[model samples]
Target: MSESAPTRPLLNLDALFDNPVFAGGFGLASLGAVLAFARRGAISTVGLIRRRMLVNVEISRQDPSYPWILAWLSQPREQTSFLARRLTRINKLSVTTTTSVTANGPTRASFFLQPGYGRHVIKYKHAYIVVSREKQATAKTNTGEPHETVELTTLYAHRHIFEDVFTEARALALQAHEGKTVVYSVRNFDWVPLGEPRRKRPLGSVILDEGVKERIVDDAKDFLARRQWYVDRGIPYRRGYLLYGPPGSGKSSFIQALAGELDFSVAMVNLSEIGVTDDKLAFLLTKLPERTILLLEDADSAFINRRKREADGYSGGTVTFSGLLNALDGLSAGEERIAFLTTNHIELLDPALIRPGRVDLMVHIGGATRYQAAQMWDRFYGDVDVDGAYRERFLKRLDELELFGEAKEGQPVTRTSTAAIQGLFLFNKNDMDGAISMAEGLIPPKLEAEQ
Candidate 1:
């Protein structure tokens, strides 16, 4: 190769500047200074100016405060903004488990979940307070005059470390007996899930016998007709139904079937499991989605027993009466929400709760009858074509089984079941045919007697 002038490797300035030995000595000192400044909440002069300008811009967007600023600055007078004055009073009061501070003064304290922001700081003559976006704080009246503690951290860290603590604190606050005028808005009753369940069983997947399906379709048709009528008249469209039957008689299944038939979502609430006050109950109701089927399962017992106990005997006696009234027909019970109440004993329900307007329909799902049993047998055996003698024998027995009702005038004779015999036979693949035949045999004699 020709002897060429050696080329420098791009002057190597970056390599020289990035020497680990030099970096270790200089970077540590610089980092320590920055940390000290941050701890003291001291911003550089240039950064302070920039922040002031940004805050002023935010203020100007709200109103032309220039005139007031100039007046106050020129006169050297102290004046507090409305927000500042309000926050000032909020900072003074100590809250205990049973007390709450009003917006008017620190004397009134109420328990509230600290939002995404960190604990509130009272400063600047109590006229200015800082609420950080990092942490959250809540206050409650201490029963033993205990002082409140303010937590400080970023929202991410706080949520990770103190979520359970916050939850328990919130629960205690909700349970505390504070004598205050509770104002429950109708919107509060509406409830939406914070996060959807990772695994959800679809309502449509519920298995129902043909007889139940027919009943659901019939009820849906009737409901739709009435709903459409109301819509035509420009009235608030609302319907309430009470489903009362023995447990495991498919009361829940029937409701699910109706929901599937109507193409509506079922919002189920176990009144017994809802551990909240009347105000919270109203909040949940108000929050319910429109066009939804609000199902209160076991509502009779839930209201009379479970809820009553939670209300300290006030619920069943008087408080629950008032609370239920508000829950059912209050201003929040908007026009489009449909309600269904299911109970094993309708007798336990208060008349006011199930009155004409509140519960428009009372459906009685009694024990399965023989007619229902025959239909279930038919459903199990319908597809199989037996020999002529067997078919004739089956028909005769079906008629006598006492499960078939007279077809309504001008309507097709649809086989319907009065019992859950299908469920009984669904898993018995080996005995299904024989069991069905036996059920048919019971029917023929009843048909002969009726004829």
Candidate 2:
């Protein structure tokens, strides 16, 4: 035998190309493209830095515009986007009519769009939709209390895209309330936004001492206009006031009026209310919008004497003294905003709550001054100007009643509270003489009741 031909080991040619068919049909270039696409898909699904963010209705109330955003996003559209993709959740065996109220409008029967998934294109990128639902007992139903499940979604996207969408959504929300004022309060441990009152009292309507009014207005103007100044000085752009005085002294009224004048919103935080814990307070305060007036009514009673309150059968809630102080000095404590703590007993307040950095001004809205009484008269009587004789007569009546007697030269007049005078006017109904006669009975007792 010819020197036995050395048998060459059988070569496995398929090993050269991991996927022989792909290489054969598409060639190396096309195969490379296919592999690249698969790699990208895998990265996007697991390795790529796509991010997810949650905006829970319960928690996001901290951001005032969150509700508006949800409304905007859920608004029903008459027509779908040309580039949109629709998803059908389930096909019903028989078509049934239904009516549902949506932000855009009401939908009846066939007019309703099927619940489905959709995408919205924003400036930066596309936002995908994924909804979650949980059965919850809701008080906001017309039917005999029913257990219903509502759908809420947490948006997912690249970080930049989410930021861009949020920024735009917030801008739109602010614009919606541009020339209007909103009242915000903490409800169920969340900030609830309420529209401006049907009848708003103008800032000019508040009959404050002339000097006090001027100072407040000037300070507000300076604070709101000094964003750059605060930034330059490394100062937290915030201001606080302690509106301490007797009840019905116009503390609350002044705040409401100030909101109107400044075109700002009012956020009322009542610490004595149920569920007002330290965390909730901090969240509410930190999330306040720019140029808002945060009113903490009855600040003195807000924290002190909590155990005594519990013992007295008051079951609302109690905030620890340290917690209140921490919240005031917390993350959201300092911003480009103004806060007012209205109290009947400033003496009961802790020193920390009224420390220098926390309270910038202390305004004592005492009983109606002679001038203030006159202004109240002009307002109720619809006068464009003060009547010297009417004012003098009113002042005389006040003196006879032992209300704040006429002021000494260059001194502020002391008198019964504005509320007392207001009650007299309200009871008499535009009868100046009648109100003057009833004013004495309306004088609050020398020792006023606790708020």
TM-score of each: 0.44, 0.62
User: What's the count of clashing pairs in each model shown?
Assistant: 49, 3
Q: List lDDT for all candidates, in order.
A: 0.50, 0.64
- Writing each residue's lDDT as its tens digit, candidate 1 over 296-328 gives 666764455434444444444222445656667
**Best TM-score among the predictions, by candidate number:** 2
Clashes of 1: 49
lDDT of 2 by residue, 1-451 (tens): 5777788758655765667775686587788899999998988776343333533223132235444545444444443554443431222212224354555886534332222222232222354443332334454332233333323334543334445556776776767666667788765544556633324467777888667777887888888888899899988877888888777778888888788788887988776665676556776676675667888776776556345334654534655565566656567586677888888887888777888668888887777787788778877765622445655677788777666655565545565677777778788775767766666675556533421
Worst 10 residues of 2 by lDDT: 87-96
What local lDDT score does residue 183 receive in model 1, on the 0 to 100 scale?
A: 21
